[model samples]
Target: MVQNLSTLQLLLIVGGGIAYTVGIPVLVKRRPDPWPKTFGYHEIWHVITVVAATMHFTAVSDVLA
Candidate 1:
């Protein structure tokens, strides 16, 4: 499916991306540490989503292009 991006869509993407990135680290239980020092698969995915969202927003902001 071809999807067109909107301001709300971008905002949601950014919010979701940040939530995932921060949530995983905060939610995961680690011994001697509240946050995960070495993130697992889910955290890795979160990082990827955050990076993708950042790039997406940057692209969207360049409205003249």
Candidate 2:
């Protein structure tokens, strides 16, 4: 199945996976202090998640279309 993927598609999928794997642990381990008062780890995690999802979506759409 992987052999069918174009290089760009493979890269996007792998990159997204890597982002999620890296981001979640960092988000957990370095949670912000004063949890209600500042823009911090959670916000950064959300952005990373969005970017990762976008990368995954791009890859899936390219493959499906």
Candidate 3:
């Protein structure tokens, strides 16, 4: 079925892409407090990135013919 991209979905795809992209360097070079090295900051950030990418893909795909 053909579908169109909605505003929220578009925003999510764009925002999630930006966050997923920007979050990496920030999480790597300069991690926030309360999430020490032992807490797997990079790993957790990667998981978040995967989730965001998945969301972006799912939303974009839904709008395709």
Residue range with the least summed lDDT across 10 consecutive positions in model 3: 30-39
On residues 20-46, what C-alpha lDDT tens digit does candidate 3 reach at each position?
Answer: 887777587755534565656676687
For model 3, the stretches where C-alpha displacement exceeds 4 angstroms are: 1-4, 33-38
Q: Which stretches of candidate 2 lie above 4 Å from their native place? A: 31-38
lDDT of each: 0.56, 0.87, 0.72
Candidates ranked by TM-score, best first? Answer: 2, 3, 1
Q: What is the lDDT of candidate 1?
A: 0.56
Local accuracy of candidate 1 as per-residue lDDT tens digits, 1-65: 11666666566566656655665554364223324567654566565566666656665565325
TM-scores for all candidates: the values are 0.40, 0.84, 0.59
Model 2: how far residue 55 lies from native, Å: 0.5
| Two-way lDDT contest, 2 vs 3, winner | 2
lDDT of 2 by residue, 1-65 (tens): 89999999999999999999878875887655235356677877887899999999999999999
Position 27, candidate 3: lDDT: 84
Give the number of the best model, judged by TM-score: 2
Q: Give residue 63's error in model 1 in angstroms.
A: 1.5
Better of 1 and 3 by lDDT: 3
